[model samples]
Target: MKKWLYVLGISGSLILTGCNGNAEDTNAETENQAEEKTEEVNEQQVKKEILKAQMELTNTFKPYQQKITAYQAAVSAEEPDSETIQSTGKEAKTAASEAASKVEDFTIEADLPEDVNTAFNDSLPSLQAYYEHVESALNENLEEADFTSAEEKFTEFNNQFNEIIEKAGFPAAPDLMEEMS
Candidate 1:
């Protein structure tokens, strides 16, 4: 009888230990799942914030892009006169100057991820540089309207802008020659 009692006690102890171990494993699995869920939520929020900033920047810059397209179209028209070229240049220059000023006032929302903010911040300097180049080219054209030089500058600007947009994953700006066609 004593041997039977001893066997029952040992069996009961083993069962209890097994139950405790299973409970611990379940708790660990739940914790892991909760952590993964939290990470997914954070990633989603970051994407949302980045998308919002991109849309805002695109909307704000659209008018200036349209002005550039208009200038390109005007100049590319058949047998454009010196007066027409100069007028278009002045208009484009004015638009570029205004765009540069607008860029100064632009702000990304604070909720964006740090990496996204850094990317946007880096992108702005290139845009600013391109705008400055545009202003200078237009100013030169206004002073002594040269269709040859104006066309060259326009091509150069478009190429550079396309490269920049591709790198930054931003929307493509209107193409000058494409608009003319």
Candidate 2:
């Protein structure tokens, strides 16, 4: 009978130990699940911040583009002095270049969604191309003899600039100005 009591006590202790181990295992699994959920939420927040920064960059481009367009209109209306037109074009190009640099700096450190990153990357080349076109237009010497050709080139550059804004999912310069007003 003493042996039987000893065996029963040992069996009860083993059962209690097993129950405690199971409870700990369940708590550990719950904690892991919670951590995973928190990580997902953080990733989503990062994506949101990235998108917000990108949109702000796009919006900033509009005003720079509008200034360029206005300059082009002024040049086309009359063959201004070659030096004056070139200076204005240079100033406009410099401003646009600065805006592009700011957009490039508007990056997020978080892992962005694949599609969003792809879309953003795709737009970059367009921005670069627009910059090159504008730079070329600004560098051209618009003498009396070449004024007509320069005007044509400037118009072409403006069209490319518009296309870039469209590809970047941004509104045209005029529309952005209207919205701002």
Candidate 3:
């Protein structure tokens, strides 16, 4: 009876230890899962920020595009109304200037990779330069305009924007140079 009791006691202790080991493993697994979930949530947040920044950048530039469209339509009119052309031209110039100013303020506050953030932040200046060029070219009370350099500047910005967004796991932005012409 004494030997039996000792054997039973040892067996019970072994069983209890085995159960405790399993509990520890379960706790570790749960921690790993929680960490993974948090990482996924953070990644999603970064993506959202990148997308929002892209939209803002696009929106900021849109007014200038609309004004350009109005100017183009006026210029292409059969009679080529000088009054309409001048008004639209001035509007476009103002829009470009406004866009340029806004671009400087349009920053991606996303917590992204350093390269991605730098690329995004750096690209905006090119867009600003594009608008500045357009503004300067249209500064004089304009009858006609040439936007070759401005388009080039825009292309530079667009390409950089596309690269950075793609790096951040998004598709390229729209090609706007043709529309500009």
- Clash tally, candidates in order: 0, 0, 0
**Poorly placed runs, candidate 1 (over 4 Å):** 78-84, 142-181
Flag the better candidate by lDDT, 1 or 2.
Answer: 1
For model 3, the run of ten residues with the poorest summed lDDT: 172-181
Model 3 quality (TM-score): 0.70
Local distance difference test, each candidate: 0.66, 0.57, 0.79
| lDDT against true structure, model 2 | 0.57
Report the C-alpha lDDT of model 1 over 55-91, residue by residue, as the tens digit: 6766777777667656766777776677766677777
Q: Which ten residues in a row have the lowest lDDT in candidate 1?
A: 172-181
What TM-score does prediction 2 earn?
0.48
Highest-scoring model, lDDT = 3
- Give the per-residue Cα lDDT of candidate 3 at 156: 96
Query: Which window of 10 residues has the lowest lDDT sum in candidate 2?
Result: 172-181
Task: For residues 34-143, write the lDDT of model 3, one tens digit per residue.
Answer: 99999888777777887776666566567677887788688878899888999999898888888888877787655677777888888878888998988887875378
Clashing pairs in 3: none
- On the 0 to 100 scale, the lDDT of residue 32 in model 2 is 100
Q: Is candidate 1 or candidate 3 better by TM-score?
A: 1
Candidate 2 error regions (>4 Å): 66-133, 141-181
Best-fitting candidate, scored by TM-score:
1
